[model samples]
Target: MNPLAKLDQLDLEPAAKTEVAALIQSLIEQAERDAKIIQAKDAVINAKDVKIAALTHELAYYKRIRFSTKSEALAPLQRDVFEETWNTDISAIEAEVEQLQDDQPCATVARPKRLRAGRQPLPPHLPRIEHRHEPEFCTCGQCGKDLVKIGEDISEQLDVEPAKFFVHRHIRPQYACRACETITAAPIPPAVIDGGMAAVGLLTWMLIGKFLDHLPLYRLEQIAARDGVSLSRSTLADWVGRLGVALQPLAERLAWHLRQRSSLHADETPVPQLDPGNGKTKKAYLWAYRSNDLQPGPKIIIFDYQAGRSGRHAQQFLQDWQGHLVVDDYGGYKALFAATRAHPETQYILESCIELACWAHARRKFFDLFQTSQSPVAQEALNRIAELYTNEAEGRDMTADARQRLRIEKSLPVLTNLHDWLQQTRLTAAPNSATAKAIDYSLKRWAALMRYAETGDLPIDNNPVENSIRPIALGKKNWLFAGSERAGQRAAVIQTLLGTAKLNGLDPAAWLKDTLEKLPAWPNNRIDELLPFAAPD
Candidate 1:
């Protein structure tokens, strides 16, 4: 039936055996050709990878020159300056130490004592009692004036709503049919997820604190304990995990929205995820994508986390995305945009990260300048860069088309001059010089890195995404890593919702709760209504 199978089933006599062997050899050659074709396709992928790596290498900032643009009056701070800043009342400490034999206080500072721990519970089910008689007294000693109660203004303060486990009361009241018609007294509520314990509000609160606010679950547990509530960190982790599963559809839609933009900014930061089977740990990647489309549409930001920085991972994550993607020349992205079906798409454009190759980084080549702060060369670079940024800042609010045109008309000449001067400066500059290396990097990646200026849709700097990534970077110091792969994705989903809410200028808790209740019954065809940019009623 099959060509290869036919080779095994060949019928021939003794004389014809040699001819049959020749036929088999031809079939083998055909198989070899197919293998070569596969390898050729792989080669194309490799070529793209090489190009991306080359670009990424050019953009990566490795060496930095610590330039001091400050004047000599503000020299590098002494260690004591830090000591004085960190410790309270330095002069008081010195004077007190000098006067004291062992330990003595001059005076005690009166401050409200802060409660550290322990909470007293209220008595159960106490009913309110009110006296009919007026209790207020007049300011006068005698009956000079009598204060009369005209109207009672009842004010209520909710001091405590006690930490309690929540239960969704679903009342399914049945009705009997009398005249060929049935009636029911209760209506069912459409929950975000069926049989899910986590309410959307509580779930979003956990995420906002964990990701957006960089509060670790353990710390959250501590905070809860202080509030007379005790929730386990493990339980919190599971809550986030389940939240991720629920949000996957939205995350995919977000990625799709990001790709629809004219361009996107992407970056990756490392996250440590635990490995259960091996009793060891492994690396995880938090890949972030941000895009603001000004074509009469709302801005969208999406964050994703993958287990590894593999080329295949990028390909799969961005499977639905197509557009000009602005990213540092990461090889992972190169492989993705190469062999994947999204490859060769006319809408998909790759713009290089040129802002990273700025004069600020190049100026860092001179460490001595930082030590002197008064160094003229370092000051010259700083002054030049300051002017460029100031000029560009003026165009930030303009339309993408206008921004592009302005960059070409106004900013192009400054970049051209800076590029030429840096090349000339690097030729004779010291090889080991920080200034020289920075200049060299800027020169090499000048074209690709500066590509942002070519279009108004792209930012002059990759700051929007970088700013978003900073919270996660800071968070790693406290919470550290995900306990597992699914945990990392959970973090990503929470971060996405929080970040999107911030973009929409809505409270994260409110949005998450609304979304959860709305998402399940949400018409799959009308998911856009849930997007941050959707029109309000």
Candidate 2:
């Protein structure tokens, strides 16, 4: 039945038959080559399409950076029908209040309005210098009568004293024994930096200025020069370096304390490090670990600096640390979780660390697509994720058991529906498109994302640690880069203490001043007493 076989069976001379067969074979070969060419062309077209999509996405991203607000929150008008509904509700409330006042037998009392919308009164703890004012005459000129003082009105305006520099002279008075001719003198107190001129107070001030205030050593040096203190940048750097070595023990203790918690949030941010050999800057990472926001204990945040963003960095920092680690879907953490699963018997770096994926990260992907593409699918995903956030908001202050029940009652259904929708949506979306990638990211981490609902101790997202990273991100813009790897590590040490102080609602300057003063003689075992939260109230 083959067309070639029919040609073979045709009656003709032997040479004519052979010629016909050769022509037919040549045509078939040409047809096969043409088909291959068409297939190759199709592949090229597909590759070009992918390239175009990527370029378009990149262009959109740059446009957003130029024109859009960085916040993911919707504008007021887009969020709700603010003009129509909010105004109507306010007017109705005012009318109702007026009607109620009209029906009252007594005169209506007007509510006191705020003088202006700005700063509240300064804290009472701040020292005040009172200035008294009195009239020139005690008696009124018009009445010619004696005036009695009733009450004094006190108005306060904040005042600042510029930086003052002074030298502390450690004068040692010697006494000679009358009979034995032996001399004795009082011993000087120990200093934070031995043989160094800087006092604990000065060191503390410099640290708070640089780390908390995000001022670099060079800038601090300039500020000091203006204040008549000619401290060089190298001198300031030396102090910071020594301080880092001295306070390293405290940072380690904080990390130990964090690991002991049942659950904690983990995150990392990029830091630029100076590569002396290359004469260029290289990227490093600051790994952040903090106790759960809902947990009842002294809140602690520790930053561990690493030269690379490798899984080994986190593993080493969290050595044998067993707890729930709430983090984003960074592949570096996967190895740690895998170790725990593969060898439950052996104590690995993160033997019992539970991986809880962040919903915020997953939602961020969809949000980016929605912002760029204005896709309905992305918007739907956002709406669903928002519901989970609402549930978390309601249960934020609740106990673990109560929050777990609340999540089950409210968030679980939404999560289930979201998962199903993402699975179906993935099939319809183009394989290489952004929408598909977003869907794939969420679906792949579905279990980890839902793990939060299992316990109230875990947060729905790793926002707390992410929030802690913001300071470093902002500081990077000012300080630019660390002088070396060691310098970066030093920054991490100070950042840990300052970050922990902020979390505990303590002033960084005050905490550092007190800690630095006592840390010199503070016993190793009682170091916890010197922590920011444990410091004198």
TM-scores, all candidates, are 0.62, 0.76
lDDT comparing candidate 1 with the true structure: 0.63
Question: Candidate 2: which stretches are off by over 4 Å?
Answer: 1-115, 341-351, 535-537
* lDDT, each prediction: 0.63, 0.82
True-structure RMSD for candidate 1: 33.9
* Per-residue lDDT of candidate 1, residues 1-537 (tens digit): 455456557676756877777787898899999999989866755654454444333323211111222332232233334444533343343334333312323212222223245544444454445445545555445766766557885433235553354555666878878988877667556665566566666666777778777888888898778877678988887776666787787777877776666566677878888888888778889888877443445656777889888767656766655555655545666654454342366855543212232233333443355455455555655555566676578886787788788888877777777767667777877786756655565566676546666666655545567667777876887887688776787778778867877776777776777887788788889987786564565
The weakest ten consecutive residues by lDDT in model 2 span 105-114
The total of clashing pairs for model 1 equals 6
TM-score of 1: 0.62
State how far residue 22 of model 2 sits from its true place (Å).
Answer: 99
Predicted structure 2, TM vs. truth: 0.76
- Top candidate on lDDT is 2
lDDT of 2 by residue, 401-500 (tens): 9999999999999999989989989999998999999999988888889888877778888888887887787788889998788888888988998899
